[model samples]
Target chain A: MNLTILGCYAATPRTFTNPTSQVLEIRNRLFLIDCGEGTQVQLRKNKIKFSAINHIFISHLHGDHFYGLIGLISTFNLLNRNNDLTVYGPKGIQEIIKLQLKLSNSWPQYDLHFVELTSTESEIIFEDDKVIVKTIPLKHRVYTNGFLFQEKIKERKLNVNAVQNYEIETCYFQNIKSGKDITLEDGRVIPNSELTFDPEAPKSYAFCSDTMYNEEIIPIIKNVDVLYHETTFLESEVELAKKTMHSTAKEAARIALQANCKQLILGHYSTRYESIKLFKEEAQTIFENAVLGDDGKVFEL
Target chain B: MNLTILGCYAATPRTFTNPTSQVLEIRNRLFLIDCGEGTQVQLRKNKIKFSAINHIFISHLHGDHFYGLIGLISTFNLLNRNNDLTVYGPKGIQEIIKLQLKLSNSWPQYDLHFVELTSTESEIIFEDDKVIVKTIPLKHRVYTNGFLFQEKIKERKLNVNAVQNYEIETCYFQNIKSGKDITLEDGRVIPNSELTFDPEAPKSYAFCSDTMYNEEIIPIIKNVDVLYHETTFLESEVELAKKTMHSTAKEAARIALQANCKQLILGHYSTRYESIKLFKEEAQTIFENAVLGDDGKVFEL
Candidate 1:
């Protein structure tokens, strides 16, 4: 799985920094997360194919998180995109998009679907054969939810040496990969575990932003391979972070530690800071595996 | 008056070109015209002061014309702007804006006033002491209007030698500048024409875009000092222009010529062609004083 940070600044779009937006590619499927203003331009600048994005996950209704969605949808129609697009977001997103389309007298030629989240409890929002996505209920000033993308477990890998010596029938190879015991033509029972090894561990990523530090979410995102959490403030601004419902770098690190995530990615720095190194330093004091997210940066898991 | 082109290309925004948006500075007031997508970035790249633009004029509800407006407004709120902002646009613009704000849960601290236009006939939309803005109805896919910004006639320059020789009273100077014959306290009468010339012929600029070639608007924009019109297609693609209710370079120039505009500015070139210089060349066939609008290019009128 590969993750690309299209934008990671807090508050507003400036000459050097942009608002929140990113792309997560898992099993060749592109999923857009938190489309802030100027996101389409960032997509173009990064050479990401606009048409490849079929699913969009919006964390909240905040303008900084999803203001660019309408324009992106309009542009897709202008480009004659015919593929159906699915959008999962908090309630009221559909109304916002519909109003703009009505005022403009333009409608998409393709099917547009919206899955509005009105529930405060965690639930599976999207699922397919290869991946499953669930909501991570977060504490914020408004109703908001983070996303957790987890890759599904795959078939076991064949052990060539064991298969050669166990007199395994070629027809039973499928059963062996499925972790089933099979009887060969020689009337000998073969154990699937002896002929095949377990598949590579599934990778998972958790995304949280615009939320205060909450340990209640630890169980939902525990043992995630990678965790991207907003660190809007440094240690010096903990009071401000709490007041604004934002997390300081130290607080973000504490969440990552409690969740026992393999790695931690910090983003959504306030526009007041000139550099994000301070955030990294603050996070590192509590969690060793902390990295800062900047515009156009990418990570592979 | 000075005009800065933030974006002038037709169709979708790309890495090299942007959609319709511009900045017009008249009498120290900055007016943003037609904010397309990515306008905030364009404004930043051009180094425009965001706080200075208190007035925005949207010609139509098309996404290419005002898709970036919500994002810009949200940015203003995020920046904690307290100044009042006035937006002039089509009748349904208020609903679109209000819906977005409602969904985003963001409210600006500043006062935002909207002047909705439903008239199909030419009318004065804005008027200040130094400038007057009138709407010129145009034929398009949607209800649209072109804007005509005319600078008010300036006070006549004092002819010091003539005033001294004629022994004109100081109080009579105001009447003379108002283009009226004035009599001094000593009973000496002076002809206004003999004392002062016409106030430098008030300069006017007419902006017409996303419309087909129509001669009906000539009277409303007649004798404009500078005319900026959309030329979405070249001579070779004139058929496309007619089909899309857009105009070709030659067609735009024809309107400028029929209106007797002093100079013609061609813009909103379709993304099909790479070179915008062709628009100027094609327009110059009928209007010699024609120029192409490029991003960041400024024109003084």
Candidate 2:
């Protein structure tokens, strides 16, 4: 799995800084997250093909989180896209998109689908043969959800040496990869473990943004390979973080540590800060593997 | 009057090239016209203060023409704007803005007023002592209106020598500046034209975009100081212009020549063009005073 941060900031898009938006590539599927204003421009700058985006996941309806959605959709139409697109977001997201399109008198030539999510509990939102997407309910000023993208384990690898020693037929190799034991022609049964090795463990990534420090999501996102959490404030601004329903750098680190995630990515830094490097220092005090999220930065997980 | 081209291209906004949007500063009031996406960022880049913009005029509901409006308004709210904002657009514009604000639960803290226009005929949409804004109906795929911003005739300048020659009383100076004939204390009648010259001839600027080569508007926009017309295509692509309800550079120049506008500004070039200088060259062939519209280029009239 690979993640590219198209934009990672709070409030508004500046000439040099962008708001919250990113692209996650898992199992050959490119999924867009958040899509703040200027996202399409950033996507172009990042050299990502427009047609590669099929699924868009919005955490909330805030302008910084979702304003670029309508523009991107309109751009898709102008590009004459015919591929089906799916959008998953909060309840009112669909209404905003449809209203804008209606006013513009423009409609997509593709099948545009909307999946409005309102549940505050963790639930699966998307699934395919290669990947599974689930929601990590978060606490924020508005209704919000974090997304967890997990890859599915593939077929077990076959041990060619073990298969040859067992004198198994070539047609039975599929059974061994499916974790089935093969019966020899001499009336002897060989264990499937001897013939096949387990596939690589599935990797998972959890994105938690615009949320306060909530421990309830730890169980749902436990042991994720990477966790992207919004650190809108520093440790000194704990009260401000609480008032705004945002997490401080240390608080985000605490959550990442408690969830046992391998690495923590901190972003959505407030413009009030003189520098964003302080976030990395503060988060690293609690979680050793903390990386600051920067626009156009891609991480391979 | 000063005009700043924020974005003047057809189709989607690119990394360096923006779509349709511009700022017209007249009478100490900054008016935003046709706010495409990424306009706010452009405003920041141009160092135009957001609070100075109290009025926004959207030409049409096309995404390239008006997509940046909501984001700008939302940014105004985030900046804690207290000044009222007025928007003039087509009939459904208010509903679209209100619906998006409602869905996000983020309404403006200031007074937001909308003047919905459904008129196909020329009519004044905004009027103040210093300026008058009227809609210039245009033909497009959607309902579109260009704007004509004309400065109201200012107070006549006082010619001290002429006033003294007629022995006009100091108290009558105000009346003379207001274009009223003054009867001197010596019972001498002096014409107002002798007392003062016209105030800069009341400079006018007409913005006619996203329209065909319709000559019916020549009467309304006749003899304007400056006219910014959309030249979406070159002379070679006249057929495409006719089919898309757009105007080519030659056609735009034809309208300018017929209306006797002081200067013809060509803009809204289609992305298919390899170079924009061709538009200026093509337009200059028919109209001598033709200028090209480029993003961030300011024209003082």
Q: Which candidate is the best by TM-score?
A: 2
Where model 2 places Cα greater than 4 Å from the true spot, the runs are B165-167
Per-residue alpha-carbon lDDT of candidate 1 for residues B173-269, written as tens digits (9 for 90 to 100): 8878888887767787777777887678788889998899999999999999999999999989989888989999999999999999999988998
Candidate 1 whole-model C-alpha lDDT, 0 to 1: 0.90
* Model 2: reference contacts kept, as a fraction: 0.73
Maximum-DockQ candidate = 2
TM per candidate: 0.97, 0.98
Candidate 1 reaches a DockQ of 0.74
- Please list all clashing residue pairs in model 1, or write none if there are none: none
RMSD of each: 1.4, 1.2
Candidate 2, residues A10-80, lDDT tens digits: the string is 98889999999999999889999999989999999999888999999999888899888999999999899
Instruction: Give per-residue lDDT, candidate 2, residue B266.
Output: 91
- Give, for candidate 1 chain B, the lowest lDDT window spanning 10 residues: B182-191
